[model samples]
Target chain A: MARIEINQSLCKGCALCTLLCPEELIKIGNQINENGYFYAVFTENGSCKGCALCAKICPDVAIEVWK
Target chain B: MSEKKIFSRPKTLKDAPFHFCPGCHHGIAHRMVAEAIDKYSLREKTIGVASVGCSVFLYDYFDVDVIEAPHGRAAAVATGVKRARKDKIVFSYQGDGDLASIGIAETVHTANRGENITIIFINNTVYGMTGGQLAPTTLLGQKTTTSPYGRDFMQDGYPIRMTEILATLEGTAFAARVAFTTPKNINMAKKAIEKAFQFQKEEMGFTFVEILSACPTNWGLNSIDSMKRVEEEMIPYFPLGIFKERKAADVL
Candidate 1:
């Protein structure tokens, strides 16, 4: 199974990926990053399926989803 | 290279009773945007920011979700909406006064941040909403309410070339100025707009489309006269074409 990793510092908490993902795989995490902004991280159900849905939904062009 | 002429424009535009005056370039610009969204299949996901000045009614014009911002705040509002809903294609429609004058700060910062959004700036030289007062892009020696005689360079300074100004910023990924002066120029503007949108889809950076539109009523010129002015006068001051372009290689 493929997983997702977010460069927390790069994430701007747009939540676009979290919203557009057909599967509830990504979400805003409780912790903040170096930028002091809330970042999305992986969880138990975090298998991304490599659909690139996360990448497609990012506005700042921040997310990079790989298989 | 030869390109394909896309299909006809959206039917929504065909609806009669257009609020705009005859020969106003806003009509063409609006269709261009809708055509681009249709070609890219972004209709359902696109959200537009309606700006101040004459184009404020953009919300009613476009067949998409539109949000309004205070004069010159469209970029910042668009940034927020785009950030919150990343899947949606976001763009801001602004006039010269709105974009180049009151909103210069937002415009510069948004381009610097490369927020993956499109800015459609209409530079018609004069402010259409409040009266034909001189705009930031108002041509030198052009008469306006503020400059009753003409825009004296000594007092008012020269017209701002927005695309040129934005192109100098390192954060700007794509910046181009286009005009709706003639059929030939319209085609060029279409290609430039396509390229601007493509940059965002490819995750390059920010994109701006500066259109030298015509404000016939505010300009104190009839349709033909304004069109001629756009072709003969405005083009000289605000020439068209891509000012800056960067491929993925340049970024990484």
Candidate 2:
């Protein structure tokens, strides 16, 4: 199993991770972060493959993954 | 079960949020450089030289000691820093306008002199901090604040390939151009940065890593589209690869 955490306040909601996630588990959430951007969130439960594609492509270093 | 942490903020980076515009790749580049410093355990001895342009605040982001250099003079300042303290690991973070336009002479001479320093060059094709003026790396026909009619080769000349040019000099130990538009590219870029830092640590000649970064605010495009532009447009002109590498024997 893989665990994912996103620093919501630091996320810029660029959605590059959303587009890069192989499992499509990441998505841009409706709730706005403190920076006024719609940050990305893990949507599907237990679907994370821990590929870390999202974390790798996150320009802001907003995403973290543990496997 | 307590999950082991696989990814998190690098120790060399500060906790404060980045001030870069949304979708800008400076944050990624900064994180990579910080990670490299952490990997080598150079946090205590590393001295970063921050140059002008969008990345002028580089000192605030990195945890190590950093000095601000005037526009296009980061190489000169870094030279002085490295010379003063040979025990310290020194690196410079500069933009295209600072490195290739106004500071090209300093950049060339520093590299030619074989300074044991690493240079992280951000090539966004435009002057990002000053409202998107044309830069030395701006592609032909690219539109910018100064080049409203588009960059005409006849009028503006050609986009200068600094990495390729620096590769020809005898002083360069390692020179490569990398992009950060995708996960694979980011990984490659990280490897390149690590190698560059390793070379500096070994006291090899000058090392340069040119990262093709995204500037959505300056490019007048959305984040995703700006990233696409890097792949579809910029890659054709810049061509990512190691332009030069010095073997152990070559360094001696």
Candidate 3:
């Protein structure tokens, strides 16, 4: 099993993570974070492969992945 | 089953969050350098020469010892530091405006003199910190704050390909141009950066890596579109590849 955690406060809502996640488990939420950006959030689906593509593409370095 | 962490922030990076603009490539570039330093166990002896511009605060982001240099003089300062302390791994993180414009003479001379140092050049095509001014690497017909009518070849000479130019110098041991818009490209870029550092560790001559980065805010594009620009617009002008890799045997 694999999972990912995104530090919402550190995210700047670039959406690069949402685009790079091969499993498509990450998304930009409607509500903005403390930084006034829509921050990325994991959908928590059981399909995440923990490839860390999202973490790699993320300019904010806000994602942490575990498997 | 026990959980294992697959990915996290690099140890070389400080706990403070980055102050770069949203979607900036500086963050990714920083991570690449930090990871390379960690892999080589050079964190303790690395000295980073921070250049002026958007990345001026590199001292704050990277945990390694960093010295701020005057505008466009990072390569010159790095030369002094490396000469004074040969045991330290010295590097200079510079932007297009810093490396290709005012600092061009120093950059060329440093590499030509065979200084054993690493240079991380970020070519985002515009002066990001100065509100989108025309840079030496700016593409033809690309509009900037100063070049409102698009960059005319006659008015502003052609874009300078620093990597290719430096690769021609005998002193340069490694020179490559890379972009991290995709996972495959990012992987390649990481390898190239690590190789640059590795070459330096082996006491090879000057090493250089020019990264085609994005300036979303300055380019008037959104984050995703700016990254796409790096792929479609920038890569065409500045092809990605290892232009030169000199073997120590060749020098002998």
Candidate 4:
């Protein structure tokens, strides 16, 4: 199993990670962060392959993945 | 279960959050630069010159010494820093407006002199910090605050291709243009940055890497659409590749 963490405060809700994730586990959530951006959240943690594509494509570096 | 950290932030980058808009490529570029610095263990020896623009507060992000230069004067300031301390690694982070328009002379002259410094040029097409205005590298027919009806080739002349222009100078050691639209492109851009920094470490002549970045806020596009704009529109005008690479024998 892999683990993914996103710093909510730093996430800008760009959703680039959501679009790039091969597993489609990341998504823009309705809940807003302190910065007011909707922010990205994992939909199915078990489905994450830990490819780190989301972290790699994230311009904000808000996502971290561990395998 | 013992958890080994598989991914984490680069030590060279501070823990503070970036002030750049969401989806802005500056953060990615900063990460790549910091990674390179960490890989080469140059955190203490590197001195970055930040030009006037959105990245003016670059000093706060990088753990190394960073000096703020007047708008478009980063190359000149970096040149002076390198000369004063030849043992130290020097780099300048500049935007399109800072390098191509205001600091064109300094950038060109510094490269012509073969100064051992690296330049990371971020070309987001428009002036991102001071509002979206037509920049020197703004694509023809692209609209901005200043060019309300789109950038007219007749009035705007044409988008300035600084990488191509700099490659012609004999003093330049390496010059390339790269984009950051997809995962593959981001990896390529990181390699290009690494090569540029490596060239400087080897005491090679001036090196430059022009990164075609995204400005979603100013471009009036969503983050995803802005990335599409870079690949679809910007790449056609600003082709990505190493325009010049001086071999060991070619170096003076």
| Runs off by more than 4 Å, candidate 4 | none
RMSD of candidate 3 to the true fold? 0.8
Segments in model 2 whose C-alpha atoms lie over 4 Å from true places: none
TM-score of candidate 4 to 2 decimals: 0.97
Choose the strongest candidate by DockQ. 3
Candidate 1 has a DockQ of 0.01
The stretch of ten residues in a row with the least summed lDDT in candidate 3 chain A is A18-27
- Tens-place lDDT digits, model 4, residues B38-149: 9899999999999999989899999999999999999999999999999999999999999999999999999999999999999999999999999999998899999999
lDDT of 4 by residue, A1-67 (tens): 7878999988999988888888888889999988889988887657777788788777777878777
TM-score versus the correct structure, for each prediction: 0.75, 0.98, 0.99, 0.97
Residue-level lDDT tens digits of model 3 in A15-37 = 88888888778888998988788
Model 3 chain B: lowest-lDDT 10 consecutive positions: B14-23
CA-based DockQ, model 2:
0.79
Look at candidate 1 and give me any clashing residue pairs: none
Docking class of 2: medium
Tell me, what's the RMSD of every candidate?
19.2, 1.0, 0.8, 1.2
